[model samples]
Target: MLLSSAKLALQDAIEASPLPDDPELQRNLSEYFPAPMRQAYKKQIDNHRLRRDIIATDLANRIVNRLGLIHPYELAEEESVGLAEVASAFVAAERLFDVREIWEELDEAAMPEATRLILFDRAASAMRIQMADVLRISNGFRMPSDVVDELGRGVQKLSTGTEKLLADESLVLTTRLQREFASAGAPEKLAAKVTHLFDLDGAVGLADLAKRTEIDPRKLTNAFTILGQDLGLAWAQGTAALMSPSDVWERLLVAGLARDFQQMRLEFLQRLTRRKGMKDNPCETVNAWLDENAGAIRQFRSMITRARAHTPVAPAMLAQIASQARNVLSR
Candidate 1:
């Protein structure tokens, strides 16, 4: 309940664009917010310009989610979370021109470069998702499950949320390409051997990518969130043939996503279990990690495909990508 409340408060803060005064806001939320929660929220707010930064993000997500359930053949690009990648790029410009369309009204200041880029990427992504490359390969493809049946083996697992600046930037660069290529709808788009601004192997960390590409790690992080959600598959629950796509996706995918999402979420717990910091394997710590991370490993590893089109990963990233392959098997 506290987590739920805290999450709601954070989302509200993002939407309303207010800096919560620890003393005043915390006191106001006193009935709903606990002391510990106030302290934590304050510390985070103080630590990062998170409130200022989220200004564009909350808006982008808002628009992308609005354009849902397009024909699989359309391949429109939505934002990171939605199905599209190409059209997502354009949505930014469209939103800029149509300021009064969604928001109450806007000053020219509203369509900053950051906001513009985000919306455009989301709109383009909408187009890409419509294409649904995997689903499109099959003729007379009538169902999402068609993908689950064939080439399910071809799907790749998304890596856990990493906090690296270079990796973050690379993802940002790659995601934009995913949108563009997704619009291009060529086999080489998601595949390797295509030249892009950032190469998968060009840099391995946020710092490196930022230095080389001039993209700040902090900015890259937000873009990364969108990219991960976009590139990541949406396998929600399973609906009975009697069920709708929404039902099947929810029953099937959400559990797996949540299972893995939580697994990596307990990062510190996982690190301890591996005994990475100890001089030798502390059997106790090892057991603790296994006890905690085992389920995540199980659920997570099962969902990876080990390969995505054209893209090849180093051993570590490849292992990370393999989860998609496994999800198909179990499902």
Candidate 2:
């Protein structure tokens, strides 16, 4: 009788309590809240009747379906329990519905426990599916689901074909370069041959870092294509000077090094222009930059020299120094 009376009392309280209609409060609070908070608030408001257990069960079913476990009977009770726990944790974190947020959260530095890792993997899988759908729509590709399969074989094939074409072009260019440079008494270095093609003699040593064997031909093609586009736009606007294809290729190769050595490259270029008093010609500018930055190169070499000098010391201290140097060099 006491339990029955308590249940009746709880039902009466729930029935009496209506949700607060506070649009003004929501608006005011949302002005100060971050995007994730506002999204969570909206989701909770829209689905207040949905219990956490129901959400967890739904998530578990979706996960099993994604994993290709078609029969419900294939999901053992023990496995279902773990899935429910992971889903419950995900829901509690307010990422049950926001697939993008869930994906980003998975990139946190600290390692997650097993349950959270499973949750993250499910989120990542969902994100991949979303991206695939977007790509299909943008590319206007149509394929039967069975033919393409879940791994998107049709898209993979398109990518592989494009890569093969670019690789073949690179091989042709390599053979032509080998013959032409060998005829001209060029040093056997691939960088020297590529640089000498545009009369850029000074940067041959630094260009060695970007080995022809390592760089993709597609990347080089894209770089020159962008340069052409920019030059065309400049010509239309009558702002920048027109450049020959060879001159632009030299500039593009030197510009590519900006990614690995931004500050040094920029300072070197500025100082070179000041010293050489050159304008509107990238080939001349780059050659001058290389000549003027010799001191800076020597300083950089000195830093590496110091880094290589490892004196005998305690094992623990030496290990720490080595690790630190490794991090610096890798950067």
Candidate 3:
């Protein structure tokens, strides 16, 4: 989806390109254009890419402005070359921290099993990816560059960088860890735990595994501190984009809603979700919750439909979440 902010950026990038004034230069831009962008007007491509670079930088600035120098929001570094790596790194780290806080204030019981499992799984994955990457770099490797920076004075286009995060994911974790685990190295130690936690899929107890692996309980106490707390969560959360195609679109839409709920129904549901009695049976309760957050639901609808030329529905499972959200509001 094109963000409203980026629509203007795209237009401005077109205006700035050298191609518009020179037909021959325009032809070259077309000839050299990558396949994904081949269909775009050559002039448009130059202008868009140029502007997109600026927008990417601007996005960098905006993050800096609000969050300061934090994981996902921070400047691109050698470590961040694998953009997908960082995407999961940031969100997974963030979720780990968030879960820890919630666990402290309440308990793991406060979170839905599915949610916790997903979060824990992501945290483990993020740690594994980062540790492997640090090893990759120290052994001599470099990350690719960000597509561009900032908006308007530029445009900000999104791409997977040069790497495609595949579904089968031939991530050589097994081979890499087999080599790394034989050592007394710290990352390897962590990687071993990552392998277990990830492999066990939330079945491994944080304490039990620490004993079996002959690792420190305190050291194993918090995976976030061992890796990046916020970075891991942010990494997992960001990789929501990389989920199987069947899963992503709606998840993003729901996420878009979760971030913006404002009505009484939503507020009530939010409050209830954060409360103790939140159970698997919250369907009726959720309805009540929705009745409380109707305005927020409307706000969500507005965001999706805001710049739309046509009313869109994907007929996906995500609609279930939206429907559930509305059901809560209606009650």
What TM-score does each of the candidates earn? 0.24, 0.18, 0.21
lDDT tens digits, residue span 1-331, model 1:
6434433433443334332321222222332335676566765544445443343243334333333333211232111122222222223222222222422221122444554344444433322322322222323222323333322221211112232423343445556655764454433422222322123221112222233334343443333333233223211101010122245334333323322331231222223333453223333443444455456555553443333332432233333443542332232
- Across residues 1-331, which tens digit of lDDT does each residue of candidate 3 receive? 3343333433343334321233222333454557777775645766765543443333333222222233331212323333333332222322322222422322223444454344344443443333232222222221111111111011101011101211112134334444544342323433343343333211112222333334333333222121111112222222322333345445445333322221222233334444344433334444454456657656644533432233333324333434544443444
TM-score of 3: 0.21
- Give the lDDT ranking, best first: 3, 1, 2
Stretches of candidate 3 above 4 Å error? 1-242, 246-315
Error of 2 at 24 (Å): 26
The Cα local distance difference test for each model comes to 0.32, 0.30, 0.32
Q: Predict model 3's lDDT versus the native.
A: 0.32
Q: What is the TM-score of candidate 2?
A: 0.18
Better of 1 and 2 by TM-score: 1
Clashes of 1: 78
By TM-score, the candidates rank as 1, 3, 2
For model 1, the run of ten residues with the poorest summed lDDT: 234-243
> Regarding lDDT, does 1 or 2 come out ahead?
1
**Worst ten-residue run, lDDT, model 3?**
149-158
